[model samples]
Target: MDWQYENGRIYSTDENGELMCEATFIRKENGEMDIDHTYVNPVLRGQGVAAQMMEVVAEYFRKEQLKTTATCSYANIWLKRHEKLYPDILSEDTSDQAVACKIDGKH
Candidate 1:
């Protein structure tokens, strides 16, 4: 899938030019970014589409040497699952217990 970066979000569209999925981030001071939103079209759920988008976004952060944090539920959950794989790009705030609980589907 092709990804487009605009207005603080990375998104993809379907053949019909419809939005397929997107991940949004807010830039913070000190070279940090908060990934505050992630959405996947219903038909694409459970197909790892969102994960793929986040991976690309994560890579972008790594390339720009930016720190990533998560506030949106999807972003938080994704971070908890993959944070270990991206220690360099992820924010240290992920150590919070709340993120862990969210990863366990408690929130």
Candidate 2:
């Protein structure tokens, strides 16, 4: 399976071009991006497809020096598991329910 990123979403496909998984995000007014949705083809569940998508998004955020907010529960949990890689982006207060990411005007 090949995983690819495009249009603020991560997608996976098999050799036959069948969609296996997708993770979507929205760019917020604050120049932050919020991962809002994720879906894995039922047959592809438990195969780490979603994890791969999350990893890609995380790397993109890091490379762009952008903070990320995860509105999707899965993304939230993923972030919790990988806090060290995003310490500067994660909310320090930890009280706000919304996940917010901020970029330093780098876009």
Candidate 3:
């Protein structure tokens, strides 16, 4: 799927322009990128779309030479799972974000 980029986001939309996948990041004072939210439409779930989005985000970080931490639960988990592939971009500390996420008012 083709992705679109903005200042701190990468996302894709369906033909009708409905958001199909989205990942939003917050830029930290230290130039770290805190991936704060990631979403995949229900229709696209179970298709590895989320992982693909993460890869795109990771590649962006790699290219920009930015450090990454994730406050979004999914992003945090994904970063760890793919740590071996993105060690250079992964932040050394994410404990502060262990309980971070705004989905379903869970934050």
Candidate of highest lDDT: 3
lDDT of each: 0.78, 0.73, 0.89
- CA shift at 17, candidate 3, in angstroms? 0.7
Model 3, 3-61: lDDT tens digits are 99999899999889999999999898887889989999999999999999999999999
Clashing pairs in 2: 67-101
Residue 76 displacement in candidate 2 (angstroms): 1.0
Evaluation by lDDT, superior candidate among 1 and 3: 3
Residue pairs of candidate 1 with colliding backbone atoms: none
Please write out the lDDT profile of model 1 over residues 1-107, one tens digit for every residue: 98898868899999999989988777878667877777788999999898899899888888888888887767777777887788898777755524322222233
Cα displacement (Å) at residue 48, model 2: 2.3
Ranking by lDDT: 3, 1, 2
Each model's TM-score, in the order given? 0.82, 0.77, 0.91
Distance from true location, Cα of 76 in model 1, Å? 1.3
Span of 10 residues, lowest total lDDT, candidate 1: 97-106
Estimate the overall C-alpha local distance difference test score of candidate 3.
0.89
Report the Cα lDDT for residue 20, model 1: 96
Error of 2 at 80 (Å): 1.5
TM-score of predicted model 1? 0.82
Off by over 4 Å in 3: 104-106
